[model samples]
Target: MSTLPVLNNADMYHHYSDVQFRDGCSVIHEMLKPKRGESILDLGCGTGRLTMQLASLVGDSGRVVGVDPDSCRIAVANEQLKKMDDIPVTFQLGSIREALPLGPFDGIFSNYVFHWFERAERAEMMHQMYDSLKPGGRLTFVLETNQPQPNAIIRDIFRLTEPNLDEESASGMKMDVPSVWLQHCSDAGFLVELSEVFRTEKAGPNLDAILQFLKASIPNFQPIKLTDDGLHELDSRYKTGNGDEVAFSLTVLKVLARKPQES
Candidate 1:
């Protein structure tokens, strides 16, 4: 919520549509198989792609609330949902770390969002989520697992820009292992239901396509400060096996936990 660098609207819209949001929606839907007449909350629901899908899943008797920190993204999401009539949906501009307005939802879902918060803040956010859920309500989150290749790239970029990049540059919020996230959820009093790492590969036909993908999937790439030489270096490094495309594997951590019933 602080004055972080904002994403370019046009570029982000293109990137979101072309790369990130589609896959993210699929992952979230897979994790949350919503049923009819069930209340749902979408944490960090950028552009409302999943939120709208959730609305359809929940039907007229149910409600869906989407929350995000960026007002621009929320505005876009609202505009997208306006075309549809008579659907129960709400969008709020706020950080997930803070208290949420609506509570006791049947399910809480998020994708590619939690890694943005600091470790302690993430723990607190999990606690807030736990309190927001009804007894036996489900909480599921999909986040990037800290892997060697991505971490090396991130470190190199930060080191190139500024030798003494702080915790922000290091992305201290990202959980190094799946166990760490599961531990945090368990510590927050959630009954751990499922937790595991999933790996998938994405391919781009060219360097431009790869850059577009990164712009959408990697939030920090939005604020990149790269020298001309650095830019060229990156281009040279990311290439495909056939030497005609750019392909890379992304490692992810998927977790499903539930709020405990009181005695």
Candidate 2:
């Protein structure tokens, strides 16, 4: 396990249990199209939502290894999979920057996880993925694009609270645009197969739902200290637009690459 302390792993998993999957995972699933009996690595497999789905596709003959930095999340994932009798699935607690236990996998799948690494470290992580995979192994990852919704009131509040926050601090990591990410993959010796950007709108049924979503999705926002008046103002603004139907946009970049046949 990594020595680095993870912040509120159990809270994170519990908060995101009902969170909806963006289009990025769907793109990865389409690109991967995991065949029976193929080995897969689900890097940063949070609560095993997508990991479980991948396991189903891989079936009993195939192997699925789900790894996360948070031990609590790993525990939750293991608990979730414990009831299943036939699927060949294993869960590990680790970060992508560290050495992985098993490797040369047939496919690597990640969703909404890579943006957590610093830009300087991202290339090395990609190289690590390259090293962990067999020649011609596929790598699919989904990352957030740094585009906020236009005329977004909630975002305005977030900006007001933390205007000078660094990208790494605000996001709990760094993120790059699609082009830069693709370049990083190419530099890591992966043959770029597919890359694209897509946007999605998330709707919270009520102010509480929106706040819960924010607390789960954005780590920096979780530990925020808001005064009573500030909280009231935020709630009032969120309730103004659509009677508690708060809508926010997310921009995501999806990439699918393959390790070189010789590397």
- Best model per TM-score: 2
Model 2, 138-223: lDDT tens digits are: 99887777765463544555655666765445546465667888888889899998887877656667656666655655655752
Which 10 successive residues of model 1 have the least lDDT summed?
1-10
Off by over 4 Å in 1: 1-14, 17-19, 97-99, 149-173, 209-233, 241-244
- Model 2 TM-score (2 dp): 0.85
- Local error of candidate 2 at 225, Å? 2.7
- On the 0 to 100 scale, the lDDT of residue 119 in model 1 is 64
The model with the greatest lDDT is 2
For candidate 2, give the lDDT of residue 152.
53
Clashing pairs in 2: none
Off by over 4 Å in 2: 1-5, 9-12, 15-25, 97-99, 151-154, 163-168, 217-220, 227-243
Give the per-residue Cα lDDT of candidate 2 at 226: 58
